[model samples]
Target: MKKLYIFVLVLLSWNLQGQGLPGLGAGTTPNNKPILHGKSWVAITGKPLGASAGATIFNQGGNAVDAACAMIAATSTMWDVLSWGGETQALIYNPHTKKVIAINALGYAPTGATVDFYKSQGMDYPPQYGPLAATTPGTPGGIMTMLAEYGTMSLEQILKPSMDLAKGYPLEAQTANAMEAQKARIKQWPYSKKIFLPHLGEEREAPEVGEIFVQEDLYETLSKLVEAEKNALAEGKSRKEAIYAAYDRFYKGDIAKEIVRGTREQGGLFTESDLANWKVKIEEPLHVNYKGIDVYKLQEWTQGPALLQSLNILENFDLKSMGYNSANYIHTLYQAMSLAFADRDFYYGDPAFVDSPMEGLLSKEYAKERAKLIKEINDPKIGPGDPYPFQGGTNPYSDILNQNKEALASLPADQLNSSLDPAFIEAFQSGTTSVETADAEGWVVSVTPSGGWIPAVVAGNTGVGLSQRMQSFVLDENLNPYNLPEPGKRPRVTLTPSLALKDGKPMLAFAVQGGDSQDQNLLQLFLNMVEFGMDVQEATEAANINSYQMQSSFGNHEVRPGAIVLRKDTPAWVNKELVDRGYQIELWNKTSGPLNAIWFDWKHGSFWGGSSDYGDDYGIAW
Candidate 1:
């Protein structure tokens, strides 16, 4: 009853509040009493309630790292897109220390996972079974790591808000819609259905905005962690043990058994040993110098290298002179992306398994070699480039041959006739709910947590389909494996979280949530803020575009026609230039991505942040 009362009060408060920004979905509300007086934070998630979860942490005196963890936990409950059981990567900036740290919270393949092992089982590759496909979730590991290194608040204190919210809260329309969309699968998992389907035996419409939504099992799970933490503290258990215990409950205890059993029964490959041996790897971040700014990016294991390459190519062009979002500007950006992506397909991979010279690849000299390919004024239909020989020679046809082989191999032998069709190539361009925040104490964080292409609907996991991440692999033209299967290799991913600094201080903290569009959106937003001198709000409001017309570093080799997509709100002059550039223009009804950003204006001595009002729910606080 008390819980119901508190929920009602929150609902009332929500109704009375004014909406925050334009692109930030429906539930955002601005708080005048900023959490950081001279500092600001922007958090973007798949749902509004999720952003609020993190904002609450900021209000409770937690720093940006804490806020990021809180937001991730909250979003796991509400969005179900990515959860604690998924991969996580982050870039944290500590202004006081004047240092930036990268956290690779990506899960490793199980010890039992080997290329030969799959062949022995008569399966060509490891299947995407929920259990088999599940990597040890890195979100929890990453969060704990950050908390231990930088956060001031205790784990229990930091997690309280998420725990409370998980006990029960009013379901929103978006969440309810997702539930309905995956109803059949939810009904399969009795435990999941128990939490998601409260109506049970009775027929009823899905729970609405104000109705209570509870996940008792999840609550119990979290409660056990809290209790274990307390008990460990009392029993003199080391901090590592307490953390391990909390993680054990999910991966090695009852939950682990359930996951293992489910996978085994489904003929999956995840073994108990796999769970026991999993550990997160910490590696150096990929950094590049762009226009006098030292830009830091994640390594090749993710799509970070692509952004580095794109920036390098962009630096070759006079982008500002071309004008922001103008046809010339967009064309140059697309061309740069194309050249960079071409290199990405052939070279980017796990450094441990593949001899990918990521450092050399991102070097200024390499950028210079790649930049020479871009024309200053002419925009041809940009194509991919060949990988530079490790021995330092050019092999112009190497990438083309490799890409053709990959395309042919991916198709079934019987369907090989249509395998190399250009139409099919263009279909691949389709592809993060990200979070960013900075506290007054100078702790800044950017996180991109994602699970792509839902696999088979897991029975009883509340229509919560697992990620078919295995599809991210790349193959050769004759269908031979180019990026050979290897255990513990981080698949080339599109999710990259970024931070920008000026004058040795955290100037702009930004991230974009869109697969291939991430770097494109980030580039646009950066230019909007730095070149055009737009404020956070205006920068966010500015319309931007992306393309499948370009090739990428990963296996997405489709080159789309000259089609440029723009927000309906873009000015007529911008549209005219796009048409003049021979682009078939398409207007996106809702902005395509949720780009959340916060900037520190040294000149004004103030902090400003804004969230996109796109199809995402985002918020900002200072």
Candidate 2:
């Protein structure tokens, strides 16, 4: 009963905090509007309650890493967090150390996952869903890693709100809508059905708004992890040591053994050693300069550098003179994106495996040469450009991809044919939620945790949903050296969380989820902030264009070829001009991105933030 009282008080406080930002107070509006919170500290998440979760951590004097992890933990409980079986990739900026670190909290294929293994089973490729699509979960260890490296808080403290939330929490509109819509899919997996579709009557309907959604199983799973940490602490482990102990329990102990046991019992490819030896990569960030600002993103394992390559090419043109959202500006955006993707197709592979032409790809000379390919007329036949005299060679992956061409031809490929509209692609690329946070002292963290949603399955009731990221790995060999299904190779991914620095200090930190569109989304938002002189809120609300001219990062990997998706409200002249340029344009009522950003104006000593929606309580603060 006391717990119920505390929860009620928290709800009341959430209502009160809703008044934090003017004009966005405690409303039942489905869409959160964009707003500016110019305080010394701020946070932004997909849901208002999520931001509140971070606020609690910040109030406890937690740094950006702690607060961001806290909010994500809360997110993992409520909606698509664990259910999506996705990995959490993050970029953390420490003002004290004056260094930015990249956390490649990604999954790798099990050792037994060989392309030939699938070929022998009458399957040319790994299944896009089910046990075959899974990898050892990285979220559990990823959060622990951050807490050990940068956070002052412990796992037990950070996960408290999330644990409470798992017991029960009110449903938001998007989450409730997803729950109802995913019923049929979730029902196919008994464990998923048990968590999401526990009905009291013969007729099971989607839970209504404000309904209390509960997940005792997930809570128990998390509790066990926390208990493991506590046991270590009780045994005289330091805070960091306790975190490591918990990591061992999750990855090398009972949990790992259970997952392996389940996999063998189910005839899956995973083994106990697969979990025991797995490790997340702590890589140095790839740095690029757009004008004077230094932008950082994960290396080739993610499609992060695509932004650098595209922006480099776009810099050759007079974008400002073309006008924002105008047909000329939109055309240039599409053309530059096409040329950059051509380079990305052949060169942007795992640097460790492939001789990634990184040095040449980011060179201004390469951008200048690639810039020459941007034409007023659309050309679907466009392919890769030379990064240098020695590099940018033949399409290595094409020969193998061609061999399996017939295999992909027989699969459920290119759902974009349904509408080729923004709605379809938006649902594809931007289906995941994003979170960002910053402390008063200049620490910042930006994260995008996506994967696991389309066809979610529990790892044998371990409460860790496996990410379907195997969909990103190719069965064809030598096609993309970086993403081959080797035992320890990281799959080249579409998740890109970015950080911007000016004068060797943190300036802007943001991230968005839109698959390959993440590059377009981040580029637009960055340009919106730097070029247009828009504040974070204005930049977030600014209408942007999306180009689908490149091969998809997932699915059957069909190229969109001269395709551009625009907002429905774009000036008719923009559409007309694009049509005249031999382009395919499909406009929709919504944009393909939901951006969350926080800006640090070091000179003025102020922090500002905004999201896709505006509510008085919208942006994060206590």
Provide the overall lDDT of each model, using Cα atoms, as 2-decimal numbers.
Answer: 0.61, 0.73
Relative to the true structure, candidate 1 has a C-alpha RMSD (angstroms) of 9.6
Candidate 1 residues lying further than 4 Å off, grouped into runs, are 1-46, 110-133, 185-210, 238-241, 252-254, 375-431, 452-466, 475-484, 550-561, 569-582
Kindly list the per-residue Cα lDDT of model 2 for residues 1-622, writing each as its tens digit: 9999987866775543332211222322222454555555788876777788888988888888898888778777776434424688899998778999998877777887777776776664566667777766777777888888889998988999888988899877776767677777667666666666656254646677788988786787788879988999999999999988888888888877766765555556778888778776788998888889899988877888888888888888877666667788778888888888766765566555566777778888888888887777876656666565535465445555454444534645343242375444643463556789987777899888776664467666665667777767776653454456766656777888989999998889988766788778788888876765556765665677877777666665556776777888776877887889877777766563678888887777778786764211246653
Runs in model 2 deviating more than 4 A are: 1-34, 81-85, 121-125, 263-267, 388-427, 477-481, 614-618
Q: TM-score of predicted model 2?
A: 0.87
Clashes in candidate 2: how many? 18
RMSD of each: 9.6, 9.2
lDDT of 1 by residue, 6-59 (tens): 888666655433211122222244432222234445454556777787777877
lDDT for model 2 comes to 0.73
